[model samples]
Target chain A: MIILIDDNPIDTFIQTKALELGGYRGRIEAFRSAEKALDYFQGISTSAIEADSFILLDIRIPSMNGFEFLDALQRLDKEVVSTFPVYFLSSSLDLEDRQRANTYPNVVGFLEKPLTRHVVAGLPGIRKAAS
Target chain B: MQISIFARKSDFQEVTHIKGLLKEWSPKVFQYGETARVGKLTREIVILYKPQLTEELIRIAAEVRILSPSCYLLVIGEGIPGMTLFHAQVNCALQLSEIGRIPELIHELKARAERITSDGGSMAMQELQEKNKELEKINFELDRFVYSASHDLRSPLTSVLGLLYLLREEVKAEGAQRYVSLMEESILKLDNIIRDIVAYSRNNRAGLQIEEIQLPELISDVEPGLRYLETGEITVSGCVKVKAAFPFSSDRNRLVTILNNLISNSIKYRHPARLPEIELNLERNGQHIVLVVSDNGIGIKEYHLEKIFDMFYRTSDHSTGSGLGLYIVRETIKKLGGTVRVESAVNQGTKFTITLPLAYA
Candidate 1:
């Protein structure tokens, strides 16, 4: 499942279309805000399920941004964090944003904006544990 | 991580004392497993505690059926144990707030010693926290430098563009119209440059110019004075209060600059055909004061939120912005020992909460 979290409805549409075009037939859940995604996570995971799944989160939002969302997710059960791979997706090519994102261990990668076919292909990766 | 280093003979009494101690710590760092140590018999010499001090602890220890694999329990106060080897473990579940990369635990030692404190581990943790805080301060300075420098330039740039506005009108005909547009384009470019300068400047300011400022009056007066693409209703949404540290005469012009820029930003990014809605709300509590400048406009995209204060960074093709408004806002706020935080949604709107010390007038 590919979950797209952003405040832009148009970008969400554009990205979803791009994902489909890229041959992603899986369910693509579009979240208008991070809070909605958080609420969704709160329910699906019980006290027992420790790990969470992957998320493509935007850094800008009304209540909580992408970094805040990552922090909140890390606070969830260890199982949740282990299961979830949170990608920091933003249109901002700001160096500070990338630097700040790197400070957090939970952040997977910082992807630039305009969800083109090439960028979408570069999104998901099975990170092999480094020796 | 929260540390409760108190020693105890048994489980029940330690549990009670630990619970009381945890009120000061956040609930996130709760310990899952707990164990207490039994003292060494090799060098043994016994010390007795009087009825009031040690007897109560002994009673609790007897109930838990305790003795540790490690011969001693920070077990100094003398308590008897039963057949079951299950000892009273001093439970220390740390409840540190989950902010980011946290310090790691260095060692787990036998708790039965006279001093039950976890010194080596805790001290290392403290050092780590201090280092993290210092790093945080540096990033904050960077952000501030970017904002202040950009903000500082806005005034002079405004003056320049203000002159251009006068010149554009003085010139005549379509031929002059082209020059007017050229001047306007230059002003826009200057604006972008100002924004970048502000963002770049934020990291450059040393922690030298710090002062308390009267912010409520500043906000009230500043928003009314600037030019925006959309001139809409700007009002104090709720009761507003002063937020600066020192009292000074109302500098209407500078205040006007701040407010004008803020509100202009609101109007600058408003949705097409929608009236700009701006609010200046103030709240003071305890030692902190908050001034929130909010607007219902086109709003900022999620990705661009952090870089909004960055120099020369623009999110859309709309070209009317100099981009230094918030950067300067941040710098000025930092100089006054204050900070700015932003919240926005793409289509909803944007809100900026600028906080300053409320220790003085």
Candidate 2:
């Protein structure tokens, strides 16, 4: 199952639907807020976070923003945050954001917004080394 | 939306029973809250029996408010004289005393339950929904993380193997140097994986140790590390100034790391045409010392703009980066109570605006 923490319901719907259309081989769950996602992070075991598990996080949120969420997680078990991969799937290409996400141990990569078939196809090997 | 209900203090006993039933059996109407209390509440309740004292009625009303807000009472002993114009005007539903008389009253009560507490129940449900969403977020992050780690890391690692394969060639070609350079990218990726592990796991741990230092001095000190970079010509337009808040603030090593990440990234992503145009503007804004690093490079695509700081994120342009460099820069900046921003477009160039708080360790 893949978790997506995006504020826009339309984006989640389109992406999940597209993934479905694309025959995305995994279950997809979407969240509109980062606070709830963070709460989930608190509940989950690092082991429960599968290698194929991915986080599609957006930086902008009302209560607890993406970066703030990360800051909160930093207080948590590093293994939980870092062991699973997180990718910044946001419309923002800000240099500082990229740097922050890249430097973060939990964050595995950064991708532009709008998950496309081309991006998916190019990403076939994203799960090759987790084991 | 706010709702108000007025019942008599004397009617509190029967109302409590109805309220509990409403909470237990019919969650649809009057929620568990906005319910009932017989004593010590601010609102007035109808008094059907004894203890109709204004204070007692007030207390019961207050209790009712604390418990069930949609539940207020009237103090009706012999008559309804004390009933306020509004209280007198309250919409009356089923009279509890006659609750047993009408079977239809049951249905009406059920419907009233739905209407009364519908918004409150919805609020609770919304919180639950939010939690479910969070569960989904963590799960997706896990998938993407593994995906990026596997693919991004594997490519370079495989390249290393390919280099090894070429090295195995009995008659090595002169392209060995080129192959080694190419292979360097993978080694960097591996090193990046290790560094990220350290940073991510230890983000909250206090690692700051501040010491006052000049920016020019810091840059000059780091220049020797650039012996490998051939930035033959460059222009730093304005007088590079020096001003830091801490007499001695921040982790020196981390500062160096941040600078190196920015400078190296600038050098690495420079436009093939521009080759070497880099600018670093340091200035102050209200509470932050902003470091603006602009590069005349190929520039980032609009799509990849937001995620440049994410780990292992090399644009489709095939730029080779440790990916963790920018991420670490961000983590360090945040630890120091600073923030970073960027502006870029394909072919136009890219600008990174970083704001560091004036206060330091």
Candidate 3:
């Protein structure tokens, strides 16, 4: 399962295409806001989490940013956070942001915009599913 | 100190005596010609009077007092039998024969000078503080403008890029594909302009954070975006010389921005005849770190070299640059207390040499 959190619908659609092009057969869930995504995560039963879930998150959003969402995620069950690997997707090329994003334990990678199939297949956790 | 002496031509001897007496004070003395002009006086003044000019002297003194209340005034003459009102205007009065009282007049002048100096100093200080506060308010407003502008411009651009991407797959006809590609190109150009605007604002507003940076890593990070061509010979040499022992402290984001803009410009303006070749050399020169980004591409002419760093300046007729790239580069470098110099000729290459203070104080 792949969860895509982005305020822009266009970005989400493009990411979906990129993931499909990268040969990911798993189900993908996308939310426009981090709050809605957190709500979805909370609503999901522990028994329903069968496969490894990966999240592609955007740093700048309307309600909550990727870091704020991670802080909120820390309050939830550790099993959910540890099971899911989160990757930040942002248009910003700020160095401080890249360094700051990596501090989150669940954050696995930080990729630049126009996420291509190569980038999707290159992610360590997503590579298995992509292949 | 400056002093103005006023008197009728008949009282020339008395003026000479006064000038002689006050010669030790090194005062720049001026002879007053008109009573109406006394208001324009900027220095302490003395009036040598006679009984006949008593009313004229009093009128001029009043005018002087009105224009410059702090200016010191002294009056000396034979005692006017009918004039009891003369004492009200001037600081001190002495009979012409009483030349010994000149010391008293000098003392009063000294005290007035001291008061004016202290008062004027405080007034100037207050004005400066007020101007500084006004400037700070303007800066704050500008920062707010940049923030709102970035949000307004960037959100739509993100959506446009997304829509273009989706439209690409849906439209399969050759002509339609060509149109979509052209639209995509235009939108990307708009996106680049928006990005540059945001970067320019951020560079101006954000406080500098000094940290140790690996030159090679920083260059490599921004290199990916600068590679406009699919295949090009872009070599980053002199990385070995910039080892861990060499301490370089600067704002990482600003440094990246400067390098990114320069590298991108090199690729963007490459000559179609030759493959784009960019070389970035970094080295430590004493207390400064010098980075040179040179490219063998369409070079800037001598006339355009000076104006290239100006905001919204483009050198080439077929250039696709946002024109803010070099301007932002120069601005960011200036903010970091660094200097950038460019050297180029037509059809030859352009080289930019930047020297930055290792640790910005």
Q: Which candidate is the best by lDDT?
A: 3
lDDT of 1 by residue, B136-188 (tens): 99888766555444444553454454445444545677888788778766865
TM-score of each: 0.32, 0.36, 0.65
TM-score of model 2 vs. true structure: 0.36
CAPRI band of model 1?
Answer: incorrect
Model 2 chain B weakest 10-residue run by lDDT: B77-86
Residue-level lDDT of model 3, residues B271-323, one tens digit each, is: 77876677767788888888887888889889988999999998668567689
Q: Identify the runs in model 1 with alpha carbons over 4 angstroms from their true place.
A: A1-131, B1-179, B191-216, B219-261, B319-324, B331-338
**Pick by lDDT: 2 or 3, better one:** 3
DockQ of each: 0.01, 0.02, 0.22
**lDDT of candidate model 3 versus the reference:** 0.68
Interface RMSD score of each model: 17.1, 17.5, 4.0
- The candidate with the higher TM-score, 2 or 3, is 3
Q: Candidate 2, what DockQ? A: 0.02
Sort candidate 2 into its docking category: incorrect
The order by descending TM-score is 3, 2, 1
The positional error of residue B299 in candidate 2, measured at the CA in angstroms, is 1.2
